[model samples]
Target: RFPRNVQLCVLSFLLPSDLAAFASTCKRLVSLCRRDQRLWFSMCHRRWGSQTLINKWGSGRISYRRLYRILDEYKNLIGFWRRCGDSAAPASSSPPPVFFEWGPSYIAGSRVFPSKNKGYDAMIEKPFLWMSVAWNRKAMNYLDSDGKFVLNEEDLIGESGFVENELIRVNVGKNKITYN
Candidate 1:
């Protein structure tokens, strides 16, 4: 039989669905796969370690497995996106291109604009929205007003200003963005 460490290593490589199948094979593996912190932590770290601090995701209150699921669901939001729709505003008033990037505990969407410094190919980013996994494992999104991400509950304007649970839907395969 493989050592526990070796078994964990193997299990970490499997996708969540595959891991679930492996766990269903026997009771011992079910216990190991569901209860072992190391395995889930390893899976989360391996996937998103370079992008964000996996430990900071759920503030240590939730399991790494839940964190993995949350990040996996929202992984497609970590790239550049442009607004596509008819705007009543004039062409000059059109929204800027948005760049979504991973933060320590949230995915932040920023408005990308050419840098004020001339002759340099640098772009400036201003935070526009922040998305995070709430304590209940539901996705939460906060709109940034005044060019800063909301830090406190009081900073939220109203229901119309921010969305919860179903904020935005992204079709990565088709490069489409739908607001819900």
Candidate 2:
């Protein structure tokens, strides 16, 4: 029951501190307890500004992966809603987006291993927002906050998908692992 004209800057991310104490006052949106820039922009800014807001939201205190996931999901949702609402939209506007482009497919060869000193967790923790697939002789490894190491795609491996870009958080061991 909010007026569409509500000012954008006042719709805070509900940050506990000063930025916009008023944002925290919203009773229903308590789900997004953090100061998410996307919510703010959606309430106030135009669609084109979404990318900038997403980048800003990511660079803040939250982990890059979480922010990236939120932003990525937001983008997908926006596209979905737009298309669903306007079935007659131009075909060019409704094409599938290539989020990732692997050589032929997501194969084991495009995988990286964990170093002895720095276990798998150490690298995954780093800010690795997956986008525009790039070619690399060395594939990437993901070590989640837990000690578990996931070096392969989850599609075939199932729940074994490595922690998404948060690997450096664990201690790696010198165990050689390879699959044919």
Candidate 3:
């Protein structure tokens, strides 16, 4: 049998579902899988180490396992996204495409606009949405209309059809987007 450290290293490589299944095999493994900080922290670091500061997330108040769940749930959103249907904003105020990025303590969506320069094909990013864990460990999403990180309580509907006061929910499917 491998030593505890080695076993934990191996367990760190497993998906959460697989680890849960393995943990059910015996009392020893169940205890190890449930209480080992290194295993869960390693799992988070391995997946998102380069994109974000894993340790700084949740302000050291939440467990790494919970943090892992939060990151995994929203990981697919870390890229450019364009609305597929009719415009959600007024015709006179057509909105630009948006890009999502990772942050030390949150995931932010920003408005992307073409550069004003004559020939430089660069895009500019303006902060639009900020998503982080709340005091209750729930997802807290805020929309900043002025891109100034100000938390406005007014119910503002963004170009993405998302409301400032509502939780941003997405239903991803294997072949198409579906919801339950």
Choose the strongest candidate by lDDT: 1
Itemize residue pairs with steric clashes in candidate 3: none
Model 3, which residues run further than 4 Å from truth? 88-94, 118-120, 149-180
lDDT of 2 at 172: 17
Cα lDDT of candidate 1 equals 0.73
User: When superposed on Cα atoms, how far off is each prediction in RMSD?
Assistant: 5.9, 18.9, 7.4
Per-prediction TM-score, please?
0.75, 0.20, 0.75
Residue-level lDDT of model 1, residues 1-180, one tens digit each, is 999999998889889999999999999899898889999999998889999888766555678888888889778877888776787988888888998888777787889998887647989888767776655665566554557444444443332224433234222323533344
Worst 10 residues of 1 by lDDT: 164-173
**Tens digits of lDDT, candidate 3, 1-180:** 889889988888899999999999999889788878889999999889899888767656678888899899779888988765575777767767779888766787788988898457887788766666643576555556456554333332333223534443433333343322
Error of 2 at 147 (Å): 32
Better of 1 and 3 by lDDT: 1
Cα lDDT, all candidates = 0.73, 0.33, 0.72
TM-score-better candidate, 2 vs 3:
3
